[model samples]
Target: MQGHGYAPPPPKRPSTGALVVLRVIFVAVPILSIGFLAWVAPLRAAIVTHRRADWWIFGGSLVVLGISFAYLSTDHTDDFSSPNGNVGMIILLLNAAACVGHYLYADIRHYHRLYPMVYLPPQAPAANYVYPQPPSPYAATHPQTPVTPPAPAPHTPAPHTPVPPPPQRPAPARIDQVRAELDELSDYLRKRDGHYDGGRDGR
Candidate 1:
């Protein structure tokens, strides 16, 4: 049984078809760069990977090769017009062109396959669409169109309500006592002012 702290080791790097293709190209760089990209010419995937400097190197090699082929193809004036030399010269020039053209466009996809960090499938571009911009309050679009006033909501007629008069309070049972207290207050006021007004005056 495995221990509780035991953790499985990380997975090893995966083998890709691109890595296999690169191996084939490297091997054939001597005799003939053949394989899927070579024999299947006209239609080919990137076979060999190249660094930025590799392009210049390939270009220089092509120039040197072209010059060499041209020199060999030239007549020494001894057989300048012979059919045999002419055919060989044509063949050399054609081969040089083909080599240059093939190397010029060799596959650029390599690091992705060789290194684990760089091999991600190409992300498809996000679908593009002009989303309707939210309307801005500062810029009103329909200033000319008059806004019709909303019709006043119909007013419901209030029902006629007869408010009953407040209930009549029962006559006070202490009316007599209240009147006696009032007469006493009136007499005390009259004595203080030295002006007496008999009850008969208001009666």
Candidate 2:
């Protein structure tokens, strides 16, 4: 939506040189006349700020000028020849021209040339919808298919062989059997000792 009228915010203006000139003109406008100072200062200020006051002042000034003209139209000849009156009127005309011309210059300097509406447009609710993009040709006709995962590989049982148990060792001899063998060995040794003693005595 914003892409339609993406005009940049007005440039940061009142450049150094332009500001110097405005300052000079602003100072000079006051010196021209008290009436002009009262009117022009606000107009110039509003124009530089790009606000609604400039329009109001410009309209108000024209209305006042028209009313003053109608009042003065009845006695213009008498007023024209009066001493210093002509001079004062001349000064007033010049001041008005100067004010209008300076405000115009401000408008041209600070705003874009192509579009007056660029600076200030009538308020309205902004557009909310965007244009739709065209659909892709391939997606319309082809329609994507869901991918099937590969079937789980078949489970094959490995050939099984029973493992045999190890052979058992014989049980240990009883304690009574071991005692009897020791007694037999002691008796043989006693008999041999006795036999040797008998032989020695005979000698």
Candidate 3:
């Protein structure tokens, strides 16, 4: 007799080292930027004065540098592919580009926040600063007269008619009388058939 064979178990999932590194970079960059904003007032002020493009470049550089550091620090064997030193360097370069973009955006936002008002373009003056007047007189001068309402008419009396009362029913006769009639009828029927029994007489 042949024996049954066992099925193979499922394969294990790969390590999440790369994903962990990516998440760390994502969270760390923003947190660091916020910290810098809070602690370094001079930097923040400088950012406000700088052109929008400059701020984008600054922010983008910081993010890219941070990501590059994360990539470089991760262990090679912990990931699926062998770690390439050149790959880490390339990521750093890409990060620099991203920094430039971020700086530009930040600079523009800072400028707007610090300086809300913008200069308006000049134009030729008109004949009059105020608009031409209309011929219509003031409404308060021609007040509407109040009108009084008419008095209501007197009410008329309704006709008087009597309504007939409903008929009253008499109370039912005694229950004993009804029972006695029933017993008499039953006795007569039983006697007619010659099967009458005295056992039901008391009931």
Candidate 4:
């Protein structure tokens, strides 16, 4: 049977060099990290850990970054003097905010938190500590009555003499014999009463 208590191994943590590279990329090119690396690293934790909130937070940040980028590109240039420019600038600022949020959440919160938890060696049990055994879920609630085995059945002595077979009942007469007898009786009765007809008898 599959065990409910057993947990599969945690997802592998990123290496020191890889983690360093990731942090550098996130700091140097926040947009690149927000757009792509976010999916690669931060979002992966949400998937591996089956954390729905992380999925939404990381995924939503990426989406916001994407939408703002696309919006700013189409006739929304970075010219703060004009009206479209102001709106575009606001979008860029929002996008930057989203990128920062993503970096903090993914790199700082999840990366640091998840790595140590997953990669750290298991701690040895203390010498004096006694592990408490969990109570069995299948334990009986009430004291059970002791079950007594039934007494050995008494033995019967076999008969010394050969037993005779049961009397066989004679089988009833066959249909043809029964019909012949009925016809004879009928003819005798009919002749006695002066009603006998020999035509049926081929006489």
Candidate 5:
């Protein structure tokens, strides 16, 4: 039965014969090749190694090439001149030396495939891969209104219970009724004092 398994091994790398052929073409093309070598190899090496030395080498080679051309142009004599007149030839030699140095460094790196161009498998996701939750169908149709807390009930000052005016002194006992009650109270007190005095006289 067909079942899933680990991915197959990567394809094998091709031979370098084509690259060799291309290098020959660059060398065969006269003036253009010098310009190409001055820039291409050092730039490629720099890109791979991220080294400042590679770039410095490229700049130095380019300056030397310019000075060489300038000096060569000023010398009108067809015969090879002495030391002073051969400055252009000397500078050209220096430029060639720089190109050879850069080429050797780049060649070593290329042989080891230190910075090869090959397809790499995509990296697996991190361990904390949380699957996104699907959106609810009802959410769009019935949007939930935000539930705001109910405002506190207004405070009413307890209805002023109405103290009932202290029972109104029993309606003042109708004035005459009040006088009759006071007379009865005074007679009882007088009788009580007289009885106490009689008992003392008897003793």
Candidate 6:
């Protein structure tokens, strides 16, 4: 007679607490970073003239928080571990990377936009300068000519042209030499006395 086999139990669901914590972290890290950036700007202005450190600190903290949240979100089950759990972790890491990247981009853009403005010397306004009156139609029609014709100047030799750079040569292969050196080393090592005498020496 054929015997019936017992069926396996259903998979266990994740704890509500773990899910709640994971969701909270997912939403909080970005929001916190934005808030920190906003708060630090004014504090930096009051404390330190240069606030690069503040921005960096805020960005780094957000990244750390994101990573911590991602780790906390990782849940492994005995019977049925969610394949998509790692996806959430990857997305969190990606978000952290994006935050850091955006911070760097903004910092760089800010410096680029401000650098020229800061370094450029202010221009002086022209003072006591009278605008030239437009020439009359008669004067414009008949232009004055020079009395004596100017002599042709002597020509000078052209400046030397730069020579083109030589093409780069490929580096020589040292693999053979390295192999020979390794073989020599192996030979030296093989020649050394063995500590264990072929399992013959008694301790």
Q: Candidate 1: lDDT of 102?
A: 54
List model 5 lDDT by residue over 62-166, tens digit each: 777778778877887785384534887777755665665566567556555743677889988788788898989999899999999999999988767666655
10 residues in a row with least lDDT, candidate 4: 33-42
Candidate that would win on TM-score: 5
Count of clashes in candidate 5: 0
Pick the winner on TM-score between candidates 5 and 6: 5
What is the Cα-based lDDT of residue 202 in candidate 4? 57
Every candidate's lDDT: 0.52, 0.62, 0.54, 0.62, 0.67, 0.54
Cα lDDT tens digits for candidate 3, 1-203: 87787888655433457534543454355446533222122234244466564555455555656666666666365441446545655665555444434444454455456556578998768865788777556656887678888888889898888888898654466667788899999999978656434545645
What are the clash counts of all predictions, listed in order? 1, 0, 15, 0, 0, 0
TM-score of each: 0.24, 0.28, 0.26, 0.36, 0.38, 0.24
lDDT of 1 by residue, 76-164 (tens): 65654566446545554454445435543453234445454756798866676566898776667545667899999999999999999
Model 2 lDDT tens row, 85-159: 455455556556555555656565555442344466677655865768898999889988999999999999998
Per-residue lDDT tens digits for candidate 6, residues 37-151, read 3323223222332567555655565565555456546666542246545554455555555554454444445444544334668777788578899889987889877689788
Q: How high a TM-score does candidate 6 get?
A: 0.24
lDDT of 6: 0.54
Count residue pairs with overlapping backbones in model 4: 0
- Ranked candidates, highest TM-score first: 5, 4, 2, 3, 6, 1
Candidate 4 local lDDT, 32-86, one digit each (tens): 5433333444354455456677677667756765665565566534454555545
Worst 10 residues of 5 by lDDT: 27-36
lDDT of 1: 0.52
Q: Which regions of candidate 4 fall more than 4 Å away from where they truly are?
A: 1-12, 31-50, 62-80, 115-203
Estimate the overall C-alpha local distance difference test score of candidate 3.
0.54
